[model samples]
Target: MPESIGPRDEGDTEPVRLPDGNLEHLDATVRQLLDQSAEQARQLDNLASAPAGSPFAGFPPGPAMPAPAPAPRPILELEGEEFESEVDTLTDWVETFLMDTYGDEVSTAAPWCLQWQEHEDVLAWLHALWLAYHQHKEPDAGLAGMAVWHRDFLTHTMAAVRAPGGSLSACMTDPDRPAHRILPGPQRSARRTGASTPDTGEAPA
Candidate 1:
């Protein structure tokens, strides 16, 4: 109801002076509003350009997608042909060992020795024993070498091959025919009788 204020005429151009403190306060308020607007624009720009799973979106990049597990190694399976080849090699090695070590005595004293090749069980057992001895024989076993070979290896093999129902015995047509013989007389005497006799068929008198 009081007298209404009207807009000033363009011709009234006199400048009005404000208080220094008021001018300073108004300037500070304008600067603060401008700085807030700038910060909001920068944040908007970053959001627009960010990747799908970026940490800036909100949550940290989902636990770096767990690494894939390593593949398992394949198992080795031995085939039948491989097994047979191994057996043949083992058999040949055993036969060579016998011929090299006791060929003369075996040929002279054990005439049935020629038939050993035909007996698979005999070959297998002897080959196994020979493998064990070849692995563990002592370097310093001089005379004892013959003793251990004849007693442990030879005797065991002969017994296995000459048992009543053994491979060698099964091949015999005559019941009275000997399937095998002990180590030659002199070889046996040298081992058991403690006589320092040579294995050359000479009796220790």
Candidate 2:
């Protein structure tokens, strides 16, 4: 009888093992193919959603918006001669601005006053007043009052008046009038009489 090499213990049920190197290479190829498909899908999605109004509707722009121009460096130091000259020019105007705005109340007993004539350093003093003026022009009375007060009192206390916080609001409020007292306007009367308040946010040009 021929050697019984025909019959094996395990029939066709056993799984065939692949070479380790071949299996690794196959896996790598499959991953690469999957990654390529994902990338292609992203590109399709981007193309479909391109905005019609944008300049780069089809593709990304080559360059982005240019950065803002660098701020100019200040030439004059706060206490320098150049700064003094600038302050001097502004002094006359500032003093006149206050006087014209408040008239006699600026002279009399008032919470806010600008005695521009009393200061020895007219230029610096004037600059201080101007700083105060700008500060008082704010919509918020508290902020404006704060700026003016800081500019007026703090300007004297400190050697330099470089930073005056409430000056803008100070300029806005009538120096003669307290912060609570609203200026004479139709709006004020309306509010007091339980009438409708008109749009007073923007003043006529």
| Candidate achieving the largest TM-score | 1
Error of 1 at 164 (Å): 6.3
Alpha-carbon lDDT of model 1:
0.58
Please identify model 2 stretches exceeding 4 Å from their true place. 1-11, 52-66, 71-205
Q: Report the C-alpha lDDT of model 1 over 1-205, residue by residue, as the tens digit.
A: 8996554886575567999999999999999999999888877776777788777763223366778875322111224776456556655765677656654332222333445644555656765666556534666666577678778877777566556544543344343454543232224545577666666666556
Report lDDT per candidate.
0.58, 0.49
lDDT of 2 at 126: 49
**Root mean square deviation (Cα) for candidate 2:** 18.7
State each model's C-alpha RMSD to the native: 24.5, 18.7
Which 10 successive residues of model 2 have the least lDDT summed?
161-170
Question: Which digits, one per residue and each the tens of the lDDT, describe model 2 over residues 88-150?
Answer: 666566556544653334212222324332233433554555565555666665655866665
- Cα displacement (Å) at residue 84, model 1: 1.7
Instruction: Give the poorly placed runs of model 1, Cα more than 4 Å off.
Output: 1-79, 99-120, 138-147, 163-165, 172-205
TM-score of each: 0.32, 0.28
Q: Name the best candidate (by lDDT).
A: 1
